[model samples]
Target: MLKKGQFKNAVKMNNIEKYFGHTAALKGVNFGVGANEVVGLVGDNGAGKSTLIKIITGVFPPTNGEIYIRDKKVSLRNYNVKQAYKLGIEAVYQDKSLGEKQDLWRNFFIGRQITDRLGFIKVREEKEIARKIMFDMIGFRGVGISAESKANKLSGGERQGIAIGRAMYFDADLIILDEPTSALSLKEVQKVLNFVRKIKESGKACIYISHILSDVYEISDKLIILDRGKVVATIKKSEVTLKKLSEFMLKYAHAK
Candidate 1:
């Protein structure tokens, strides 16, 4: 439990709700993620997963809710994508975050470049920094991969690695990953899971969204199960096995 006047979660939402026209997307949902924790968000399609994430990332304001980032309440009216970045929240959506044609170095600093006093991009500095991020930060030692490598030339897993490393390099407090392991091969899935472990090792929090329960079982400290716009279950990794969790979801789906 969180105490009064004490910071606990990296991000928290209280009674979150979202409405579209007369229909409700989210219904009084409560959620949170703590530092050094990996949370798996698992749910069926149209379960309001995307809607909830959008609200948290400041893509849109909630119809009714309070959001606290690092224990500080956010001003909904002023919260935007730029504000979310400023507050140390970043999202990495599968296949949508990177520029396929851009070099690795360029992708790393695409929107937020390192510039001199006169607003000139420091190309050499950016390349060196990108190298550290790729090689040291995310441990991307894949053969034939370098700072100058174009994103489109890399595999899906490699592209995800670069995106994740870039988020970490920027010092984001809470990183949200949407469908990170979708359509990945077994080896590539393992690679992505390893990258997620890096986030936990660095004492940063991650909200991992994926349909693969096995992958979630392997890395997540907690599992949040959502259904029809509500958080129905929050299971700790210790309390259940992969098989039991799967069975529970199947049963829950049928019951609903």
Candidate 2:
């Protein structure tokens, strides 16, 4: 149960810390994404961005911290990626996570397939669902692409759409996108941004991590700046312009 005046957050990490032998990857960081909020997590390399995300996604347990999902605390002692998924937290990486050699339908259900009691894969049902996800849920309109098409035939942005669509189909409450728009054409970047908008429209929370200040500013409701394993600032989009945000980040990039 939530406290009297506490706002409901999709995910919250309190005093989170992680260490690698003598090195501290994160230090007493308080991070969160509100229900249906899009949070831009911006930081330079080695700023503990990936480390923080890995902990949230249960790649590894934080050395110290508390994780709460919708006011309920999670036990970190046995937390894993599968457990994180069960908690409705999913991470979409820069890789887009598609099988190059597999068809779209196959890629969508790679590890979690639809099966009958006899253990037979429901091939046709999976294909139909994939079709709905492509054309309906995600508005994926890749030319010459269909459920039968190999994933390698899609462009970078199309791949991201597929990954995001899969996350939505699986009912993720909080989707953490790690450098989602890296190394893409201008048009392709726009494609990924549109998909993110879809996530917002569906009323799901998102933590969008990116180095592209303009794109991050465009989609995020609020921005969290992390420096040296601690949060330096949390700026609302209404409070800062893209140019100003870039300058602010540049100052941190050069800080000794």
Candidate 3:
């Protein structure tokens, strides 16, 4: 649970707009995510969900809008991928980018690592961190495979675990998961959803993007529905029904 003041407003966008050669992708979309909250971003295909994610993650600049982190309005002009990481905002795309040929520890520390005084990669320290993240933080109790098992040898759930473990290892404030369980089995999906819940318990906000309304309802605390580049409604999970949410999406599409 997020203690009072544990997580500030991780990200906020006001009157955000985006255009692709005259095609309006996002029109004044306004939303925000707080620390340790799981907010679902749901919409049909071409509903501007991807565009909004891109802008929020600094993949692209909003043509017109203001973004704030921890209540400070800041320009995102040169804040690229590196800057996003520095802000503790990490994104895990649908593909679960892991090297199938590499072992678990190697994949976990693919980009970030600690160096020894001699300027050499500290293998022992890296493995120790990976072990702690996988077993302690993530609760993965699988067969004690030598942090040397190839990613392909693991199940889909395990690969998903690796991706999530990496994000949490970096202590990301807001984690964005794009269709995380799209290709997993029912049981695997359940495992991943449990992990998402654990993420919230660890006091990190997650933006779960998916078309599966049922999954979103099960895992998210709030729902933000986007249609044709506009926010139709943002509602608390307790105050919404599947039928009502479906209706909102349909109505928004028609209005567009």
Candidate 4:
């Protein structure tokens, strides 16, 4: 639960529009993620989900619209990954951003490394913290993995867990996940999904984007359906059955 004065919405995008030359990717997309809410973005391929996420993360600026972080309007003139990270917005994609050759601790702090006053890396501290984050925050129950284990050596689900844990460790207010369970075995998918529950339990919000409607139905508190670059409907999970949500998506799906 949020203490007395915390902002209600972690992020709010008003009339977000994205264009690729003559093509319109997102048309006036208005969305918000409240604290501790897990919102699922479900749509067929090419329904503008990626475009909207790109705009949110500063990979591409919206052609027109306003974005607010913690209820304060932010100008997009200098929007970039650095600014996004500074604002506590983190993303975990299916590609698993860890360096294959690097160990777990190194991958955990790949871009943002802890350093001493003289610029020497605090390797020991980083390893301990990484171990705790993976074992505790991500619920890695097996306990065989070590901080020295290479990223490539872990299973796909375990790597995804590490990435999510890194986001939590950094105190991200809203974590965007782009198909984090793609192409994984059933067991691996379950493991990755469990970590998302961990995120919700931590009182942080998440924007989960995926084509897997079943996984979305199992986890999301609310569901947003997009068709042809526009939001078709926003339904609370409690308000409808999974079969109904699937029907809605199917009914609105169209070829671009």
By TM-score, who's the top model here?
4
In the order shown, what is each candidate's alpha-carbon RMSD? 2.6, 2.7, 2.6, 1.6
Stretches of candidate 2 exceeding 4 Å from the true structure: 1-7
The candidate 1 region of ten consecutive residues with least summed lDDT is 1-10
Alpha carbon lDDT of each predicted model? 0.88, 0.88, 0.84, 0.88
TM-score of 2: 0.94
lDDT of 1 by residue, 76-195 (tens): 999989999888888988788889899999999988999999999999999999999888888886799999999998778888888888889998888898888786888888888988
The sequence of per-residue lDDT tens digits that candidate 3 reaches over residues 168-217 is: 98888888888888888998888789889989998889999987888898
lDDT of 2 by residue, 1-256 (tens): 7567444898899999899998998999998889889999998888999999899898999999899887689988878898899888889876647889999899988888999999999999999999998789888787788999898888888888888988999888889889887877999899889888888999899999998888999999999999988899999999999888998999789545
- Return model 4's CA RMSD, one decimal: 1.6
lDDT of 3 at 152: 85
Cand. 1 TM to true fold = 0.94
